[model samples]
Target: MHATQTPRQDDPLDVETFARPEQQRRFVAAMHRIAAERAPGSSVRIYVSIAPGDANCERWLECITDDLPDGVELLHYRTAFEGAAYDWDALASRLDGLVVIGRPKRLGSRVHVLGPVARLELRSLVATKPVLLFTHNHGLVPVVDCLSQVMPPEEAPRLKLIAPKRWNRESITIRAALDALRPTGVSNAGLESFRAVQAHLLTPFSAASR
Candidate 1:
């Protein structure tokens, strides 16, 4: 797939504006709100990634920028891969929270898959802070099934699934189910998580601590 926008400095997180004027306005407002609530200065930055076939990607982002509180430094990225194997950590390093909006597909009673990349990305992020995964599809439950096998209960709990529709069916392809499983030591925390986890890196948590 072609890279819609190459990584650049000073590029608006919205990148290209929405077709609808109201949509664009709403999105910008939300982002500003989030910025203000989350961070008052340039310390916190927001990064968004758009997956292939992700229909609501733009819409959700618009809402975030337009409706959410202000002072949020939101950045947007169009991903080239299906899983979090690419730039997941890079996007997570600068922000405090991540929002993955999608429809979940179920394989079993509680096993679901939202965005494969997002799940893996979140699983990777949990090594540091909490990641909230939101989806409206019933199939999203199984995405957490393998979590029990990877990390301890507490860590797994940090990777949450926000699914409004719960699935009761178990129709998982063996091959597909195996792909959803996460392996050990495969963390995507990036620099930020590491710093947060250690708490005393090259410098202190904040300049004041020094």
Candidate 2:
């Protein structure tokens, strides 16, 4: 099914819920402006790529499909391995943004994930597209280390890796971030956290850009 460009009727709290009406108006305007600048005259076809076992993927997709703007569409790709179904050329053509979502391993646990991807493709992907990743790991150093290798000093300005704004509320920080990356293009919706803080983070950007 196609994604809606406006907020859903069922959501109790959403982008429309600013601290005030002015904030909401500005935020919505900013969103439109940003969209106009990034993908003028072009329709975006987004493809979501995520690990097979991720429980949050469904929730993330629901959030995205419910509120994507006009001209933006979302697809899904679930797998056990990285780029398992990746069609490099097709993906390149389809996507303007990507979100890689994974959990942090407990210190004493044997399950290893997230770190390697950060070690390996973080930079390459960022260089190629706007990438936003969220994880529970406290090791920011490793993320920085990997980014330093793959990202150019100049382009580094475009990369961001941080905690979810408020954990879980009504903000679509992930959505906003994806919008920032591809403007008029495709985006990944595998790791969205729409908490209060995230909503705050997105407000100014959305308002100003629209």
Candidate 3:
């Protein structure tokens, strides 16, 4: 959770050296917008779906928590059906966003196709909630890029996807996902002030913090 370099005041969104400055800036702006628009004292619940017993998936889940906004809460929902809730709609109703973790790298060039786990994840995304796809391996997340790779002319809602090479990048990517999910209301001057709040919340803290 410790960020080696503090963000420069001139560029508050520069939280990580690896992430593009523009992308980070946009991500920060979006996050602040959501916080400002969220109903008072009401949190946005993000459901994190993971395959049970996957060690790597478990680790990334723990690591990503370091950079989450205060109003965001992550709920762990395992995919395996043994004694777990299989009701996607009911779960969807309670969730504002979803993160699908621990996926296999696509073995071939089948973007529109899916496997067992990916299918389950896709079905859950039917509600059109903003989603982010992350795999334990630092490679392309085919699920997010699937539609794009298959048909260049077709358009789908922006789906955030990240496969971080390191823990720091992983946490920052999680922040991007949260920023994409958090809802924002239109405001004239809110952008300027919300930017400051995003900067403060994004400051690195102990993993135990926030």
Q: Return the top candidate by TM-score.
A: 3
Span of 10 residues, lowest total lDDT, candidate 2:
138-147
Model 2 regions more than 4 Å off: 1-39, 64-71, 78-85, 105-122, 134-210
Which regions of candidate 1 deviate over 4 angstroms? 1-40, 79-85, 105-112, 135-210
For residue 51, model 1's alpha carbon misses the true position, in angstroms, by 1.2
Per-residue accuracy of model 2 over 1-210 as CA lDDT, tens digit each: 111133346742222221243433444445445555774446455444445445666665545544444334454553222457655555545565554543434542212244343323444554444444434331111121121222234533322333322123233433444454443332334223223333343232346667
* Candidates 1 and 3, the one with greater lDDT: 3
Q: Model 3: which ten-residue window has the lowest total lDDT?
A: 142-151
Error of 3 at 176 (Å): 6.8
Q: How many clashes show up in model 2?
A: 14
Better of 2 and 3 by TM-score: 3
Clashes per candidate (backbone, < 3 Å): 37, 14, 0
Point out the higher-scoring one by lDDT: 1 or 2.
2
TM-score for each model: 0.37, 0.39, 0.45
> What are the lDDT scores of the predictions, listed in order?
0.36, 0.39, 0.46
Per residue, candidate 1 scores C-alpha lDDT tens digits across 1-210 of 111123236532221211133532433344344434432222334344346445565555555444222333344443322344556556576555444444333432222233445556666654333233333333222232222223225433322343322223232211122122212232345434543532332122247845
Query: Model 3, 117: alpha-carbon shift in Å?
Result: 4.0
